[model samples]
Target chain A: MWKSKAKFLFLLPAVVWVLIFTIFPLIYSLRMSFYNVRIGQGDVFVGLNNFARVFTNEQARSAAFITLKIVVIAVAVELVLGLALAILFNRAMPARGLLRTILTMPLFATPIAIGYLFFTIFYEEGGLINGLIPWKVPWLSDPGLAAISISLVDIWQWTPFCFLVFLAALQGLSEELYEAARIEASSGWQVFRHITLPLIQPTIVIVLLLRLAEALKLFDIPFSLTGGGPGTATQVYSLFTYRTGLRFFDLGFASALSYIMLIVVMIIVSLFFRHLRQIYD
Target chain B: MSRKRKRTKGIIILVLAVAAALWAFMPFYWAISTSLRSPLETFTIAGLGIPFIQFRPTLANWIDQLSIGETQRALLNSTIVAVFSAVIALILGIPAAYALARFRFFAIKNKDITVWFLSQRVLPPVVTVIPFFLMMRSASLLDTRTALVLANVTFILPFVVVIMRQTFADLPVELEESALVDGATHFGILRNISLPLAAPAIAATALIILAFTWNEFLFALTLGSRQAVTIPVHMAGAVDTRGVQFWFMAVRALVAMLPPTLLALFAQRYIVRGLTLGALKG
Candidate 1:
């Protein structure tokens, strides 16, 4: 009995902290979503008005669309590139460790700093890419290119993460399967498609889901690089929320937008957890 | 395969490896080089092509950025909040992690608690940002480092608990059981056996948490106005206050990247595991 009491004491602080800060605020924001909360004014209950506005609000809709677009393109690209890199590194290679360490540098660099660095590199005038090429492409100023540029930044930073995950998964594959496949005269691509891909399918799913969760919440890159501009072209959902709640002082609407985002992410994460359990079991 | 085919594959892999390295390192290299370049060179067309060869290097931008009171204060604030919050998180989380890993006493099972913890970690920061902002404002704690620290703890604590729980779970129970057999209390066993055994993981967790807190932007941006601004928050401000001093921004970017980059290098082995919250076992 005493030991059980002591164990509870050990767990108490973290539980209390999470309840007060995480749970309480989550409930507070969920309630805030149903109200009309302008800055310097008390919130007024509005009965799903803010949630209703999300569907009709053009900026919110576009922001959601742009965020989904980034998640799909960026994650797809990272999946391909990361898988390729992992396959390459899985082989016996000279200086493999050194190359991996170097490749992962961007993964650890501050995102806001990365945003600023890329902002300069993607600058219209005297940018590095423009200097390398004959033509001047508007990397940030042009709307179509701006979205691609932000996704490229996301790809550059997160590809290493996917790479490492896949590499670890690759290394964990059963050697017996590969030996049997080789003895059966299976070609490299055939072996990968039939054997390797199936083995790492769960990992691939987890990485994709994780990347989707992250890319949806991406704020610093777009926030710093383009400030969601040339004209809200790069404004993802998080930035839109920031502008709506803090910049526009429409806390109620921002709360609704965030709740919507939360729902989407919760769906993704629960899927990831389900997949994780299937793999573990 | 033929020797020639094998050689060709090796060369291709080498080339690809080098290309990947350059792709990852080039921007940081450019940023550092640009920071060292004279202002005249930074603005000029000819000086932008390749770094170091085209311009005379200078320390002016670095000196300028460091001399600014706001940047210095921001750096100090970032360090204080990151270290203190991570420490606090470790204190609050380590025991909880050990308990979840070793004990099964309460109505709440370990798996249920873990899921709850992860759900908290997975919730988008934007969801909490508004409520936190309102709460901080009401408490007159807005723009204070304490507020940032508190908000950071809310996120980082969950992560610490998750990672450390995995770490403690992986540790052999024999040592703790033996200690308990010798009449050691639960706290005694944890302090003398588990913690020392788990020290490496604890350090790795701390470093990763520090990196996360150091690079965190939204909470810092929303909660901190001026006095408690972090490096990322300051970098965002540099982007917005727009005479567009590219070199100054470069200098700040380089400075901002240093701590996390160095810490990441130190904790490289555990980074992937840390990132996935031990989901992908090696």
Candidate 2:
């Protein structure tokens, strides 16, 4: 009995750490969302009023919709780029080791640093990209281009992460399956389509889901690159939350938005995870 | 009869693959060259001009960023946050991982624990930021190293637990069981047997987690203030200031990435393995 108590006692530090640091705060936010809370004012219990305000606010709704657009587009482009790189590097070719190392570079690159690099790449005057194009696009100052530019930086930095997962999955594939496909006179594209892709299907789905969740939470590149401007043009969900909570000090509304995001992500991951598990075999 | 033709086709495919990889690698090369080049060369060179050979290389920008009070302080701040989180993560993670590996606790299966740990990473930082800020303020930890470290442990703990679970799972359990038969306690068995056996995997996971924490930006930017600002947060402030141009801030940004970039190159193999854990398990 004493030893069992001691065992549970040893678990106390970690439990206490998480409770004090994470779980307690999550509960606090839940409580805050029920009140009319701001930075400087006494909280008044206004159950569900903050959530109602979130639904009615056109700016907040638009920001949420815009965030959806960014996530869908960014995740799609990165999926394609990442999967393609994975397949390319999986082939038995020269310098495959070196290529894999280079491909993973962006994953380790500091995101803010990448944002700074793209700031130069997409600048209007005296930028490398400006020289490549016949017309100057005002990549930074223009509203539409700014969103796309941020997404592009995200792709540059994170596509390698997806690539790494898919590459590992690809290498784990049985070489015998490819040899068997060859015996059946399968074309190169057909073998890749029917055999290799299906074999790594689980990794693809997992990578896609993780990237989708991550892209929805994006803050750094857009914040550093454009600061949710030219005029709220590239504002993503995380940025919206930041502006609402920090800039406006509307903790109640921000918490509501966050809960909404939590629901959306939970739905997406839960729906796909079952199918993802089946593919692993 | 067709052997020579097949070999020729293989050679062609190899050439194309190499060309494609080079195209992919060009941006990284550009970043390295841009960081190394002098400011005069950066302005004088045209598109696609190789920044390295076209002008004199100087460490002035690197020195400038290093010498700046805010930049140096931020670097030290990031180092502290990263090291603190890594230590906390390991301490919390290894035991949970051991239990999940060696024992069945309260009907929670191994897969369930793995899934639970992974979900933490999937939780968007935005979801927690509002609550986290209020929690920090209430706890008197806002805008300090402790707040950043604690936030990181939450952000990174699941990863540590998951990777360490794999490490523990791969280790032979019989040795520890034998230790137990010799009247060794759970803690004693782990300290003497399991830890030494799993050292390489643990080291690998630690390196990867450290890299991830070092590169983490959002929470670090939000939760940290002047005294606790990380390199990324500091660079954000530098870039966001009204009059700052790309040149001045770019120098700072490039300087900030040096330690992490070097770490990544050295641990590239472990990183690939670590990031891809449970990827096959779906």
Query: What stretches of model 2 exceed 4 Å from their correct place?
Result: A1-12, A272-281, B1-12, B19-24, B37-41, B242-244
Across residues A50-142, which tens digit of lDDT does each residue of candidate 1 receive?
A: 999999999999999988887788999999999999998898888998998998888879999999889888887877778677898999988
Chain A TM-score for each candidate, in the given order? 0.95, 0.90
B33-61, model 1: which lDDT tens digit per residue? Answer: 78887777775845344554676678989
| Best candidate, TM-score | 1
Q: Compare the candidates by lDDT and give the number of the best one.
A: 1
Q: On residues B34-122, what C-alpha lDDT tens digit does candidate 2 reach at each position?
A: 66666666656767656445666667766766788987888788899989998899998888766656665454445665565666777
lDDT of 2 at A249: 85
What is every candidate's alpha-carbon RMSD to the true fold? Answer: 1.8, 3.0
